[model samples]
Target: MATTLKNRSWRLSAAALLLSFSAQAQAPEAAATPAGMSGQEMLFWVLVSLLGVLVLALVLTGILIVVQLRPQLRKVYEMPTVRPSWSGKVLGLFVGDPVLLQGRVRDEIMSGHDYDGIHEFDNDLPPWWKMGFYGTIAFAAVYLFYFHVADAGQLSQAEYETEMKQAALLVSVGSDDPNKLTDFQPLTAAADIGAGKSLFATNCAPCHGAAAEGKVGPNLTDEYWLHGGEVNHVYKTVKFGVQGKGMVAWKGKLSSKQILQVSSYILTLQGSKPANAKEPQGEKDPTATKIAMR
Candidate 1:
């Protein structure tokens, strides 16, 4: 009776140990899941992969359809051939092949002409050249049809004026009035003056002279001033200008800052004497403040 009881207990213990081992094996699998990636994540990746494969399959199928259908469609719509003369074939080889060159066709014929011992073969121009010539004719016809006959895009003088007025409204331009002059203030920094000097050399040197000694205009180097000598005044004069005096208003032509830079550059020219200074014009007031243009 006791042996029977011990055997039953051993069997129960063995079964419990086997179940614990199974649970332990399953616990590792549960713990192995990454922080961000769960079973749902794995399923999502698998679904994405399947979708990519499906898309690739669809693209391949489309390419196959196009490859199979193109030649059959072309065969169905084959164009009739226009035969050329024997002389035309010979000329066609020298220019490009007629089939290779679009729309060029040969129609004229030329036979061999023999004069004494000399023999020459006369041939017509390639069909390609003829077609090109004909294309120009067609283009002219179309252009004339659209421009003159249809008059779809034609603009009347009033319409053109209206368009010009609208376009002019979009742009900000300085006043055209000679009496209302624009002003440019000089930049004080040496770096700014240096940049302005370079700019003047490139842009203003032709008319104003390289050293700012007036060639077509007044001298900037000398204290004897024609227009106002103040920094802001000079800036304004440089930007706008004396209307009848040949100095054009550079307001729209140059940016506000660029004009200021040029003004600053002109200021640096003071005291540096150039060879031929234009005789100073305008009254020199004794109380005229010496303003730094740079």
Candidate 2:
């Protein structure tokens, strides 16, 4: 009987070890996989890893219970009258739920502890709830190790800093907030103005005509202002755009330097009235006259 019990315990231990090894083997594969996995591929691997962890945890838990209760299990097996049913045997191997076996609950119920003819049975926690709680703990440990200890993943703050650095590369030096208007002098550099003209032809021409004359949107060459005519004001308008005014925000599409270039190019067009110019719509800005002089 002792030999039989040892054999059973050894088998259970070996099975648990095998499962542990299987779960560990997946770590190398995950590490070896390319980081540029598609969304669906990443999700599939994540689910598979979680499933393997859950199965390994359950197997370990069952093996622990079996090893701890080896003597009791042997005695139950030797006693024909108290032998567990087929379902009970399966449950004992995996869940170890005493309620599934006949006479198993006798030791579980509180003796003479009845209130109003109600008796309480001390049962183990539900497997799902216990496993879920344990899984969260495991996840937290892995997250801490991955982000803080091993430095394998970026923390939120680190990621934010990295993104800010990347964005800084796209913007020119002395860039100001697009939301706040600043007295930005128009860029007179030939290269900036040329780039601005090219961009305006591509993006703005469909709304504001090719020569800054009015099309679906207002004429950009006129001194009359719908929003404002100052170079700074034009910069703001181009960056944020006017709501319900057909102008789409270009902050994300154009860098700050590019927007400045476009605004400067528009300023250079003052007084050069294009053919078929739209009728001036807004109050004229005296500032436009001063900017045009620059």
Candidate 3:
């Protein structure tokens, strides 16, 4: 009886230690992020710790199995007729009392009048099932305390807001209002023009031909102002397109710097005069000619 108690105590201790390690692994620590560890590094460390814990649990389980089976094997060696049942002596440790392990023993049947020729047995529920039920209750209480009572974890809405704030930090939001125009000059850098050429090919080249020769749109090469040909004027025109004209507004679609880039790029095509160019639609801008001469 003392040996049985000692073995059971050892099993309980191992379980407690396993639970402690699992709880430590699951609990969130706020200090790691400020310490400059990247998310991937933290996850890698967490996975390594979990793997170590798993290996330790397996070792503890093997130790417990050996401890429980040793005495039973010794008893079998001592007497052949009094040999211990493998199911009762070995597997019974996990399922509870030896008699209860393989369901109702004959002695457990209630000594009462049978109903419909069938006798009922008064048997306790399996220990493993009861333990699992109790575990679920304990887990529910802890989860409720951690998330609601103690407020240790963020709720769904709080997590979403945190993610949005983090995303905002990574992006730069320019306060330049599209309605409020700027007197910005067209970019003259070769790199800026090169980027503008790529952007134009991808976005603007479909409507305004590959060479800005105007397929469905007005010719961009001529000294005519469909919207205004000066850099700032062209910037405004691109930023906010003409209403009732097939020109689509690019305010939200393109960034302010990108609009300026494409506008400056368009201005560079003023004198190319490519073939199959559409007729000039708007009046000539003398201001644009004056700016161009300078």
Candidate 4:
């Protein structure tokens, strides 16, 4: 191949010399033709010359690479070949080699158990997984300390109670609770009586008559009562109505303040005469008399 290349070089040099001589000989003729030829014809010849020069350069480049660079490529295949393990073949792209990718490794971390004569190594957990596990433990500790020990946040039960109290507060806006059965008091303002009158007209006027005059129920005036006529007693009676006496319970239907207002309005009717008042039915009370006088 070397002898052939030497001969080819000589032949190519001779051909180039011949081609240059022919070009010199034709130059005068081509120049005279261009004077007669059109502009497109001249341009076509110029482009053909450029393409021929480019093809020659490419051929020379390929021959130089084959002669010089191919020997270095031959040395690569001659170097010592390492028959890397399967894992090394893949992992060596990024890392050099895995620790126990093949036969038993014998440095330090070998364990006792051998599966069919294969040894095991005690490698620690991956750093990232270990860190995540430890982080979870730390988070749990902080949560426990803050909520239960330090009291920085409410626990489930405490949070529930707080929410319930807030709900009760919202439900009780603009009114007092009527659920406490025995914590009764009297309210005597005109606003209280007027509100009570409105409630009574809706609730009790059918049975007791408008203006507390007698009807199906006894009159509410003239200081007489079934149960009792004291303000607190009246409040209780209205809250927990006479069950068998045809009056339904109002505690379930009214607020504590509403019951107070109704009782107050009834007390104001003590001596006001109404037509066809029902005869008084319950015992007279010393407490009632004292309160009425006051």
Give model 2 RMSD, 1 decimal: 12.7
Between the candidate structures 2 and 4, which one is better when assessed by lDDT?
Answer: 2
- RMSD, one per candidate, in order: 21.3, 12.7, 15.2, 25.4
Tell me how candidate 2 scores on lDDT.
0.76
Better of 1 and 4 by lDDT: 4
Count of backbone clashes, every candidate in sequence: 6, 0, 0, 0
Give the lowest summed-lDDT range of ten residues in model 3.
Answer: 95-104
Alpha-carbon TM-score of each model against the true structure? 0.35, 0.39, 0.38, 0.37
Please, what are the lDDT tens digits per residue for candidate 4 over residues 223-263? Answer: 66777777777777787777788877887689878888878
How would you encode candidate 2's per-residue C-alpha lDDT over 208-282 as one tens digit per residue?
999989899998887799888988888889988888877899978999899989888888888888999999889
Consecutive 10-residue window with the lowest summed lDDT within model 4: 91-100
lDDT of candidate 3 at residue 286, scale 0 to 100: 74
> Which regions in candidate 3 have their CA more than 4 angstroms from the true location?
1-180, 289-294
Which residue ranges in model 1 land beyond 4 Å of their true spot? 1-185, 285-294
Give the better candidate number (1 or 3) by lDDT. 3
Superposed Cα deviation of residue 58, candidate 3 (Å): 94
What digit string (tens of lDDT, one per residue) describes model 3 on residues 1-294?
Answer: 657856675776677567867787687765456477888998798678777766776667666766766677555544644334554445444433354344434446687857998878777676557768999999999999999999999999999999988877765454344444568887878777777788889988898899988887777888998777888888877777878888877888999899888888888887788998888879988757322311
Q: How does each model score on lDDT?
A: 0.65, 0.76, 0.73, 0.68
lDDT of candidate 1 over 1-294, digit per residue (tens): 446645555555555555555655666554555678979997687567656655665555545444555554344334333124444444343333454344343433335555775656444565578878999999999888887799865557758999978877776565443344455445778777877888889878887788888787777777767777666667777777778888777778887787778777777777688887766666553423433543
